[model samples]
Target: MSYFCGSYPIIEKKALAGQIYSYTLLCPQIAENAHIGQFVQIKAEGYMLRRPISICQTDKEKGTLRLVFEVRGGGTDKISQLGAGDMMDIIAPLGHGFTLSDAPNGKVIVVGGGIGVPPMLDIAKKYGENCTAILGFRSFDRIILDKDYFATGARTVLCTDDGSVGIKGTLAAPLKEELKSGAAAVYACGPVPMLKAAAEEARLAGVPCEVSLEQRMGCGVGACVVCACTVIRDGKKQVLRVCKDGPVFKGDEVVF
Candidate 1:
């Protein structure tokens, strides 16, 4: 993957949910090199460290990159205050992404929960009708990109924890049903618990699965060990850096 550190102009910025903000940036280099599940690190105002946000969408022709993030603390709160026309420093197109080479041959299940839902949008767009998206949120107000997923023409399923909207349950219910029918592959990103459950379901079904992990990152690059996670590689357990080795790994390979 190619990595670029530059000041990108914010083409547009808007609030999607209560504390969630979407920002579109004019970063040609990153836009051209970015893959579906790769992420970018933005330097938040007044914060010494950069915040890692996944790439939601990319327009190579237009040279634009889209990111959706939640305002969780002081760093993200500062990011939420920025508006259009502002320039933001970012290091992008980092880490590995999902594999889509075999998607056209058979049914592919794309699952995401809460903030993890955004990255799944580009996958749906690429795989088109072959992808089935299962998105889970805490409630109606936290729901995001429902229309975007529908626009991709991929079969979409939405789940809400409180039963305020869509199905009254977690993503695991629909995911289990999908696996039973048969799936060639599955891609998931969510909380640790949700990912573990999804991984186990896919494993039990004998289907190939990949998961994007979220971790506390100090440096956006591999210089720091903050994002390390235990993974079984070549039958040996090792601590891998999420920023470099992956944010994405084979479902069966992850120790969690």
Candidate 2:
């Protein structure tokens, strides 16, 4: 896929808990080109490496893309300083995206944990009532986008490790329950353990599954080889660049 590199205006900005932020950028070409499960690389002032952030939402007709990201380190911290009306240097529509569907069944279930929740919002909106979102967070304060998921008209299940809000544990039990009924596919993005569990559940349920990975990246494209992941394809285990080949991959393909 072709990528566009430019400075875009930040049209809206909002801060969420844990130094997490939602910034809506008015980049017509990038918005039109972006896909769900893809990401944007933001060049932070004074940083040699750009920060790779997941694309939270996209409004192509409106020529905007919403990016939700946490302040992880120096690069992201520099980015957090920017707000509405600021020009953000970005290269976007990067990385492989989720396969919307590969199942005969029409319903899909999306699983997200912590900062991983944003991307699932778009998928749920696409599936509407046919989507069930099993979201896991550290605690209530850690929760973000539950309302957004609800706005998508999907059944939203919130699970927190601390039981401060929603269910008292991880997504395993609820996910298993949701799969029992019937689902066309399962999609996930979170920590490796969460991804592994979700993939395992989907495998047991006989559902096609895909997952987005969170990796340390240097170049947001294929160049730097900083974000490498192992996967099995055609019976051969191979190393792949997460930024180029995928931040998204088939659940079965990932070695985990």
Candidate 3:
């Protein structure tokens, strides 16, 4: 995919939750070429390494790209403090994304946990009414983009671990039922445990599944082996870079 690296002015900035912030940037080139599930790497102020955030939303006509992130450390905290009109250095549309081509005709299940929920928004929008989203959060306050998913005409099921909202359990609660209804495909992103469970469920249901992995990265590119993940390819297990080889892989291929 074509990518652009440059400084872009923030057009909008808002806090979605307690420590979660959503920043929209005016970068036409990146907005136009970015695919669903792709991510952008932003250079954190005074930090040597960049922070990779998934592409939350994009508007090619408006020349904007949105990124949602939590203030987890000094780098992300620096990003959360920036206001509109602030210019930030970023490399856009890096890493492989989910494949829509493999999606089944009738309905596709999109699952996300915690921060992973943002990337699923674009996929729901792309699939429209044919998409069914299962989002899990730690609690009510952690919930995000529920309205956004509804606006896209996708059926959404929200769950919280603490039983403070919607269904009280893991995403697997709703996911198991969805799989029983039959789906063309399944796509997910979240913590390793959540992903592993979803992958297993998909396998049992005989549905094709894709998962986006999260890892610590020294470089946004594959030059560093920091984000290496083990995958079963062609009957053999091999280590692949999440940044270069894929942040998205077939659920069955991942070694977990």
Candidate 4:
């Protein structure tokens, strides 16, 4: 399908955290086709370039798509201030999603850090009870959507740099415990550092793993190579488009 750029009708907008906002946009076409880990590029104002944000959820029947974003800079700061009745220009359901075709559906491990946890939520919803979610943040105040994740029926583990939540360390620590026990597969999303650590940990445990990467983009779609990333395939270095080939890729194939 051709990439279509249009305005999104906002149905709901609410604060998720201090500067984080959750927007439920009405987009029947994109919602019907969205997959776990896929994202949409949206503009905060008319005539502005779009910023890519991962799709948090999609309800095709309801014609709604959700996105959770924090006010990290100018783009997101403008987004957080948008109201329910506001209209947003968006191009969505872009990029490749998670590869679940070979997923075992048995004892899956998911690790997320900070805002990176949002994309993993859709994955957890699809896998349900078979998945275990491990999340990390700097502190309790920075934590955003734990309760909803717990409601997914996946065994949820929370970690904070400080001892304010479930665990007092990074996700790798508890993830190691799960791997040692017997996790079938591991999926992760987070800052580059956390993902690097998780990839290394997964390698040591000898478990298959996939990671979702977030990068800056000048154009939300594949037309622009602004989000090109390096990956290794069959011992060869290849450049992949985060907007097209994948935001999700096997841990071993990615270059940390």
- What are the Cα lDDT values of the candidates? 0.91, 0.92, 0.90, 0.85
Q: How well is each residue in 9-101 modelled by candidate 2, as lDDT tens digits?
A: 999999888789999999989988889999999999998888889999999999999999989888899999998999999999899998886
Please, what is the TM-score per model?
Answer: 0.98, 0.97, 0.97, 0.94
Sort by lDDT, best first. Answer: 2, 1, 3, 4
Better of 1 and 2 by lDDT: 2
User: What is the lDDT for 246 in model 1?
Assistant: 85
How much does each candidate deviate from the true structure in C-alpha RMSD?
1.0, 1.2, 1.2, 1.7
User: How high a TM-score does candidate 2 get?
Assistant: 0.97
Model 1 agreement with the true structure over 1-256: per-residue lDDT tens digits: 6799989999999889999999999988889999889999989878998999999999999999999999999999998888999998899988998887743558889999999999889988987788899999999999999999999999999999999998988888899999998988899998988899899999999999999998999986888888988999899999999988889999999988
Worst 10 residues of 4 by lDDT: 97-106
Q: What's each prediction's clash count?
A: 0, 0, 0, 0
Once fitted onto the true fold, the runs of candidate 3 whose alpha carbons sit more than 4 angstroms away are: none
Off by over 4 Å in 1: none
Q: Write candidate 3's Cα lDDT for 1-256 as tens digits.
A: 7788999999899889889988999999998898888888899889988998998998889989999998899999887889998997999888998899644576989999999999889889988889999999999999888899999998999999999999998988799999888998999999998999999999999998999998888787778889999999999999999986788999999999
Pairs of residues clashing in candidate 1 = none
